[model samples]
Target: MKKSFNGNNVEICAPAGSWESLSAAIRASADSVYFGVEKLNMRARASENFTAGDMAKISRICRKSGVKPYLALNTIIYDSDIPEMKRICDSAKSAGISAIIASDIAAIEYASSINMPVHLSVQANVSNIEAVRFFAKFADVIILARELSLGQISGIVRAIEKEKIIGPSGKPVRIELFAHGALCVSISGKCYMSLAAYDTSANRGDCYQPCRRRYIVKDEETGFEMAIDNQYVMSPKDLCTIRILDKILDAGVSVLKIEGRGRAPDYVSSVTGAYKKAAGLWNKGRFSISAAKKLEVGLESVFNRGFWHGGYYLGDKAGEWSGISGSAATLKKIHIGEILNYFHKAGIAEINLSAGGLETGDEILITGHTTGARKMKIGSLRIEGKSAVRALKGQVATFPTDFKTRKNDKVYLLVPSS
Candidate 1:
């Protein structure tokens, strides 16, 4: 959708893992991002979740780039987990997070009292106008549940606009949705499979995701058995709204989200990049969602369960999760090096190599938190106070660092450049 839906603004929020994916989100087109820490995140165990220290740094990077960072407090809070959720909200405020995605009412209440903006998380199951408005009384935005239809969202967005209670300064409390990524066939993210099968509670941020596992329904009648398909009975295909970006963007909503904080770096990078490009075009008034077919390849480069569907955008269809799953993906770029400094004066990419690695004329690539990369040959690289003619064994010598890389970044070097 164009930045305007009949003159209204549209924004996009993506998922992030480490500083790399967070920066990638900004570089790509994410108007904002949502990530989780170990406490209240469902995917805390799956993705490279962020730490408090990392948020202190990454939040600054996001602010500088005009990209918002959201702290996910979306997990259902059991009786014992309330204190931890409080800590998460308090810490997020200290780190300057743009907002917090909340599901529990107490979590919402606590977050509302804080200075930060509250985006009602999907776990709240806020699918209607009144529910959205009720949360709007506290939340700055309402994230629709994954099980919502297009019609349901459209109605809620209209109600949100009707509310006179504006945001901190005088803006209407906006609406948000899960425009993409894996879907759970559970109710409002309250899955019992984890608790029932493995005694793991999804609300406690310890889900085993038994729903994604394969299952066979056997007939109880005289022990009759029938095998229809493979596992992943409840594993719905990922939500790919790239095809329906315009509808989502123009839905009078403030942010369209891609759901994957616990995903891999490749997934975070590629999916975030594709949506970033799309949103960039939309913001620039060159509206194109479906027209950006060329960008779709980036999404496939990462780990996906295949079977793309607009879920709820199209009429009801079966096998959303009944398809045979795809295989794992192995992408280039493994974690190999670290950033020492950025010698912008010499315009060289300075990086520190571990072990007896650097050889004369070897090329290394340096990627910064905010910068993609800067490539230069080892033949022309330099070490501290002297040319790195041969980087010594077990010593940390600075190599051509022209990419303006800062310390504390995970630099990746593609050896032999395959």
Candidate 2:
């Protein structure tokens, strides 16, 4: 998908929190990022929220990286707090913010007071043709609610095109969509189920993910109980439509969003890398991207709950499931040193991991983070720079195998689940 937005380039907009995640998003080729500050973002409970000052620094980083930085001012505010809210928005505006998300009607007024561009958040739940048209009246862009089908999105686009809603510069409003990550069980993300039950609010950026928690349903007739949470009845696995990203770009969707506010840095890197490659391969009419092997290989080491679906890209049949419990296993343990110059070279044949859990010798795959594949075997063994009888953890060992591994290739010791 082309990252061109109108006359400008369109790029992936990934979620970021800490410096590591921000760096990862940029390294993976994301064009922009959205995150919460200490007060306004939805993930307040997350460890890596930007302070008021931190956000200014982050703005600098974004400019240096040539990426845009957008702030989420999405929480509902009362009438009494407009003054303080204006101050925050003004500070963000001074930092060269691309946009600020607003859910309340007053958000438009507040944004105009500070002369900041406003994007209507999906929390507004502007469904149907008329609702989208209404939202476009105030927003420079709109993040469409995630419940729409491709046909529905097409319809929404037609509505906007017909109305000619003003864009950031009064050209035409941009329409962004969520292409990847966890989906809300609720339609408009207005569920009070979490706040009412756990005292945590999904609004104002502090969702405790009570959906991931277990629950018991009461039976009115028999008064019996039914387990809910562990079964993951409400918690759907993350949505990953990276393979069909082109279909979305063609839809004229302004931004391809990845949903992960509290995710690991490496996770951001892997997911961003996959989408980056896919988007690059996407041409307006010519389709010659055959990097299926590359995409699969790249996704192996990233943290995922398993079960990647086409999401709304193939229509609503793409209902998501719960995330896998063992997504952290992607990082494997491998032999310490398989090659003397593995760090410098690329295409090495076979590489050997430490014999920690191996019986005598076992065939394995050497998956490099950036280098792709370097499969090899183990015959001779050296521990602490000397020939060793067996491999053990905490022992320095060098065994010859296949792939020319460099310092960049993280060696994961593979052991499949039983």
lDDT to native, each model: 0.68, 0.66
Q: Per-residue lDDT tens digits of candidate 1, residues 1-418? A: 3544324556678788666667667766677888888767767666777776677776887888888888887777877988888887888899999888888888888887787788888878876776755666777777777666676677666665565645542567777777768777776666787888788777766777776666778788778777765666777777777766656665665677888776645466677777767666766767564566667765654666663556765535546773544422323444545666666777554455643356567655444556643344565545666765666445556654434666755555434212
TM-score of each candidate? 0.78, 0.75
User: Judged by lDDT, which candidate is best?
Assistant: 1
Give lDDT for model 1.
0.68
Runs in model 1 with CA error above 4 Å? 1-8, 162-170, 219-225, 288-290, 322-418
Clashes of 1: 14
Q: What tens-digit string does per-residue lDDT give for candidate 2 at 88-107?
A: 78888877787888787776
